[model samples]
Target: MAFNYRRIIVKIGSNVITQANGLPDLQRLEKLVDQIAAIKKSGTEVILVSSGAVASGRSLITVSDKNDSVATRQLLASIGQVKLINTYSHLFEQFSILCSQVLVTKEDFRDRLHYLNMKNCLEILLQHQVVPVINENDVVSVTELMFTDNDELAGLIASMLNAQALIILTNVNGIYNGDTKLPGSAIIKEVTAAGIDFSSFVSTGRSQFGRGGMITKSTIAQKTAKLGIAVHIANGTADNILLDVLAGNVTHTRFVPNKKASGKKKWIAHSENAATGAVQVNEGAKLVLTSTKASSLLPVGVVAILAEFKKGDIVKIIDERNKLIGLGLAEYSSDKAREWAGQKNQRPLVHYDYLYLQG
Candidate 1:
């Protein structure tokens, strides 16, 4: 099939690879891997964000009350990660394709420097034709230190890599407008910035082995699409679903790309959840930050500082009314910002290269 997107991010959810027995579904996994290989042979570059380690580990290790705890969950992820990646490596070998395992934590993307470094690493892999099979480092992840789910991770990667589209493979065919079992219910094929409110049909409940659900998927889809990348949520079990969707022969929920964003804006927008503090700017400051076209948030514009953050941390830029207007890396500590607030002769709070305004 002639797919439109040359570079794609494909997310394989835990439910897609987990069986009713709480173990990895080898047959299903093998089939999905085959489809990925087929797509790659068709001249498409693919990055796989896979989740199933914790589910697979449960079958190998006995579970108890303690197993439900965060520490135990991390142990399970560590144990199954090896087996999961090995299985993927073996399958891809049959197609003569090489793949590498990449494990990461939310901390890696929290810093702009590390974020760019990661992009460099992935770009090098793609240049050499090696597929990057990535998974969250659940071994050390807990609470806010974790991603909402792999869908959120995939969206971040899609935007970071400047991929044309992201394909989220889940158990469901797509997002439906009503009860899926009902005769009239159907998949909503497309959504955009001006789309209807589909949240009414979304269920907050997550999958048995995953942390996110339809709501999270839809939300991430819209967010990534707004940064000028398309997103598709489709059933992984369907025959050649990946190929079909790319060929425009499938019925999947598609989030069409909005106006394109500069590479820097995409980074800032996706970094919303990573904010470490806030800088309260006055009317003059807000205008200076947003209208300068390319200028730093001068210390003279700061009216207040909220929360404690060290230099080089991501901070939200708010107005005097406490409305969030932008985000950027603070060059000064919160204490420094407090000391320099309303002072015209002080250094800039945040440089222009690191600032991103909200729409």
Candidate 2:
């Protein structure tokens, strides 16, 4: 069987790693490690985004009065992360495959500099033939900085690395047309640009030790696919599921990419931080930015300023109709733009390299 991708991000949910008693399953971990090592031996690059820290931590603790509170979970994560990485390291080492652990919080991606640093680090690891095992830093993450789940994190990583595909290993075979437990519910073979409605099959029950359900996975699939990365949702518990899915020999749900955005454009468009201010422009300015390959936002076209911002800060560019046309890094601050607007000799408000036109 022909493998579909050269580089891939494989995300294993907590349910796939935890047993009925809410403990990490050693056998399951071994199987996953073996499969990943096998793929690496075949000369394919793999990044693993895994979840199971809190669950594994819970198993280590004998007794606790705290009842699954955030603080308690954080404490558990602090204890479990070591165990998780140790297990992964030892298992992969058996096959002479080296692995590194990377723990990230949402704040890491909020800043462009830090985000780029992380991307560079992962790339370096791949160059050394080391698989980077990533997990969220649950110990320090607050509500706002916390990713909804590993599924969202996986999507972000895939987009960051420009991976060809993101494979989300879950408990179910794939998304179902109807209720998964219903007699006639069938698996969705493929999901093209036109998204499928699997709302009926979505469940509110969180995994035995995980936070998200199929709903979260579906949201991740759709979001990542928009960035031109194919997303596959398949059963992680099934024997040889990872190999079969990668080899295109399994019945799994695949979300195809729509209009693929360039890597730089995707980064600019999806930056975690919002624009610092707004630049109101006439229709002509909007047309020039959207249609022409202009290198700068000419000052003569700027009509108004809605807020104050500094140079180098991201800002929204709006048309005369008040519709947001795109986001760009301001060449001039709001105060400067105000002074320069309508001036015949003033420089551009934002350079083309710093701008991203929205679709």
Clashes of 2: 0
| Runs off by more than 4 Å, candidate 1 | 1-3, 65-68, 181-183, 282-301, 320-323, 331-336, 339-353
TM-score of every prediction relative to native: 0.89, 0.84
Model 2, runs deviating above 4 Å: 196-205, 273-308, 315-328, 336-359
lDDT of 2 by residue, 155-249 (tens): 88999999988999988898877776779988887888777655766666666677788788887798688778999999999989889998889
lDDT of each: 0.87, 0.84
Top-scoring candidate (lDDT): 1
Give the TM-score (vs. native) of candidate 2: 0.84
